[model samples]
Target: MMLPKAAKDPSCGAPKHTGLLREELLVFRHLLGLGENPSQIRLGPPLSNSSLKDILFVSIDVDGPRDFKCAENSPCLVGISILDTRRLQFYMTTISVAAKTRSALGNVENLIKSHQLQVGQSNHLSYRSSKFLFGETRQIKADKVKTYLQRLIKDRFFVLVTYGGGAADCIYLEGLRLGIRPLYHLDVLKVAQFPLQTYYRYSLAKILDALKLPWQDLHIAGNDARFTLHALLMTAVRDWNYRDDKPKSKPTPSTQVTLSSIKTIAKAWRIPDQDQPSLSFLFEDHIIKERVLLNPETRKNGKRLRPEKTPEEKAQRRERKKLAKEKRKLKEARRPQWLFNLGDLLDNE
Candidate 1:
């Protein structure tokens, strides 16, 4: 779906068009790894009829392909995205109540710190600063931070990590999907072989230390995404190491386990299950679809979709066209008159 680009360079000026918020774009780019030069990064066209109204929050799933081990029972991720489209530049951070486990909290702290660094370095100035300088608005409120976070979680942008057993099961599922069989006996290694607790603590502590800064300290989405990715990678790396010694039936490439790779897998797995429908699907799926189809009929019925032109409106349009015609005529008339004048009229008289 087409998504709006974020404002990376304040020098370009605030977007005058209404739609996606600058902050949402920032978060999307961070998730997609597009970063500051998002304009150069082509995205699929904006989802048709999609406006800021449809957007509740944006999310990036950082954990491995499988849903969190206890994802059904507990929240496994945090939701950090924009809350309102009217103020597209602002961000709201949210964490799932189920994700409030000690390990999840650590990830959140790391994510906050990493984001702070990105904002600090990105050339795009903070929204408040831009508003103060260009829009002449007041400073941003401190409370918005918590509010934004809550909105993000409500929007499903964050994820919940499952229990240790679930995580291992997911890994096995990945192996099964790849068509690899165990090379050695399963009895040699324990399923709960990873040191998830240690990784979670280290990653969280690193992030919390970064978030100690003041609100004004964080500005860009790319930075936040980077830090979150860092934490994700740290967790993944540690988990991989923990599983390294285990004799698996089959092993997939490391790249296959990344966020992007998992999305591919998910899509492939989901494609066959999708219900098939016809053109009518457009009417049901899109708000504008029905309107666009009815527009011609409405016009035929003399119920103009747009406001009917008043006599004054018709007169103004006529006057405009007439003036344009007159201007052209005047130019042509001048040329002929000039030629006539250039003739020896005065001498002949």
Candidate 2:
């Protein structure tokens, strides 16, 4: 009897490899300084000083002559990761079909042949990890990708362009600093989908388009990242314009008064006799204090105290105070009280 067919190893190693590849892609993209997709972009408050150090850019590119690869496809996928706000790291992987069928391998071979690039042929997959200071033209395609990625890191905006046939679907991700946390995500999506237009919008686009070179050549991973960055910048400038135009009431005269004038008025209004008196009395005592200060003996104390108001004024004040006190007392007396003992006491009475 066939010894219990050795239990099929449940661990079909393909998943593990795929998982690792996905992680590698994330890291690779991050290192390359690629902007996150519109959905992935995290818009936070002006990053706190503490968090500024951790800010970074990650980008992943899956490039083949075609977008999708079948099980038997041997198309190469180039993944890059760039780290801004710190050092950088770049990684590249070339995957080939593992199938044994002649038909499958034949299809892979034909696809590779169609592209006119060899199965193991390498493109500019290498990259520099130093802080990108300044550059005009990059020597390698990867370097050019890195330059665009840096812009995404600094601007906190991204435009994702999905190229299909001859046309492209443009998506812009714009980061915004809102006081609320949850709104940040919602706002970015809203802005990306429907951007506000302004004269500066064109300027932003021009600057971004000029900076993104490889993006213009290959509608691949790097290019998608560059577009995302452009969209973000455009969105940011537009947002700023919107905020500047937001309606606000003109300042009142009292509010707009200069600090120096306020200080002078405060000094002039001080009561010479009263020390830290009520604000109402402070105004009334100002002239009295100035008159007292002119006399010699009053000048000895260098302070003149304002006398209590006339009997009529005081009587009026007392009447107002009594009315206010009675109103407060009446309010307090009328307040409902839920007392457990009230029913029992009333029954006994």
Candidate 3:
């Protein structure tokens, strides 16, 4: 299956000779042993006849608690980096939706604030300010996270790309029951190894540096997703033959398109420039916090509301109180006159 070489990739303005090939992509997939793991990869979706441009590359990175066990139990920040190869454009959405409870406020606030603090300290991708900086940080309900993802991948065949083989992202998305699945699964971490020739699982930041692709603020789900997709594209363009040569600093066509698209989308959002602290409130789940605070009796810790006592239980409580009162009266009646006099003397003193 010899695929044609791209003459000119308008996305990055890269030379035709260095452009990506579909055959190269297939070879890359095979080299990574992607087809061997049916449990992790789905190869039966008839991608053989499809050109690389025909498939959507969806890169997902989810941010949850450090102890993130599963998406169901934890609140997730979803970062979706989408490359529509046909259009030669990129679309990204980094969602920071907190659970509809007051309990999520502290953690969500800290994540956004920490990222805000590190915005301009370094040129490294790890310090890349999020697209949210240019756009209004809109809040959405936690339940809507799945629907938002579904809307993006609907009516499209996408290849799911992620760092660390996306085991957690798969569980998170599947747990949401997205229904739509990727045509193929590509791991940027594994894809990177073929070029770097190491079994060690390097961090996405390190892999991006190794591939000579620019990375932005990492750990933020959206930025991570964007990085993952670009990393996969850059890895695809690499020659499988081992080379001691260091990767060039030039950005790929896919990366160029991604950055441009981000700016375009940010411009469309028309968010006014302000201090980071001022914008931080938008990312916080204030609506949920406000709702939770309205009830005076409600615990701020997000515990379940106490149910009203049943008639039988109330009657039992009353009975217990009566018995306690009677017992107290009996004890008082049994008290010695000397003790009563002593208590009177102490009170007078």
Candidate 4:
């Protein structure tokens, strides 16, 4: 199918096809089997501190970058997920693109082929997981992705929770600008990384590991989205539970947030929000709290807490100061003791 073509948007890069994941559909069917209504429901606010039932997590994963000005990029695969904020594995609904053939799906065969050495040239994994992993590619693909995403975008779901409102946020907003109406604006969250980077750093595999879910046919957008959702949920849970259960008038959670993505650490990055309308909630307070133990800084209440120093550190400082003072006193007493005694005795006399 001829890929949908749009103007080149420097901000968004080139568009890519969103993969249609059939596994998600099967899961959706399983969800239906449970007799839960599949109707689109507006998500409630994502409670960073609330229980899993109180919060809902939604996320979108686009495989390729697109231009903000135009949709000239080939639409590859975009994966989306709705899940419990507390339990990432409990997926409410996962919607992804499905094509008629695996080849038609942008993120499926092509990705595995690119990693021939890693995944195998004969496509053992790809062949084995073909039927179970991806949905058949669509025969007649749409030219523009805006129309497709318009149907997928839900109200009240937070955006840019993955990349910290970086380029992903830009592409989403640009899609909103040119796509159909019902552009629901919600708060954007910027979660910090964990103190121990390796322990807290998450991926689709890591998320699956945490959930104890089987990790197979991974890397597809839909799978990625699900994993990303769970990963974020795990991070949020860690952040929430790290603090005391008791409600304090003054709370600090940033000390617990330690999530870091490629863009979040960029030294020079100012995200663009051209047509991003106010979704009623300005997220100035939505920033994740991070515990900065080493550097003493002004707190929200204007009181500056001293840098958190360990007992050993304080003791070392005290020892150093005491030794320096003793050294100076000894130097003074060395040669000056006689002269100092002479002056004192003369004055007394």
* Top-lDDT candidate index: 3
lDDT of 3 at 13: 50
- C-alpha root-mean-square deviation, each candidate: 23.2, 28.8, 23.3, 22.7
For each candidate in turn, the TM-score is 0.21, 0.25, 0.45, 0.34
- Point out where model 1 deviates above 4 Å: 1-139, 160-228, 244-247, 252-349
Please estimate how well model 1 matches the true structure, expressed as its whole-model Cα lDDT. 0.30
What is the C-alpha local distance difference test score of each model? 0.30, 0.30, 0.51, 0.36
- Model 3 agreement with the true structure over 1-349: per-residue lDDT tens digits: 2122322224645444332223324533442322223244444333332222345667777665444443255444566666554443212222222222234332222221111112112244233334533122334555676777777676777777778867777777777777777766777666565455434568988987766665555677766766566567556445323322323555444334444332232222112334333233334443322243445577546665778899999999999999999999999999887886997899899
lDDT of 2: 0.30
| C-alpha root-mean-square deviation, candidate 2 | 28.8
Which lDDT tens digits does candidate 4 get at residues 293-344?
4533456454566678999999999999999999998888677557867988
lDDT of 2 by residue, 77-176 (tens): 3332233322211100122212223333222211110000112233432221111111122323422333443444454432122212111111111111
Q: Using TM-score as the measure, name the better of candidate 1 and candidate 4.
A: 4
lDDT of 1 by residue, 307-338 (tens): 67899999999999999999998888768665
Decoy 3 TM-score against native = 0.45
TM-score of 2: 0.25
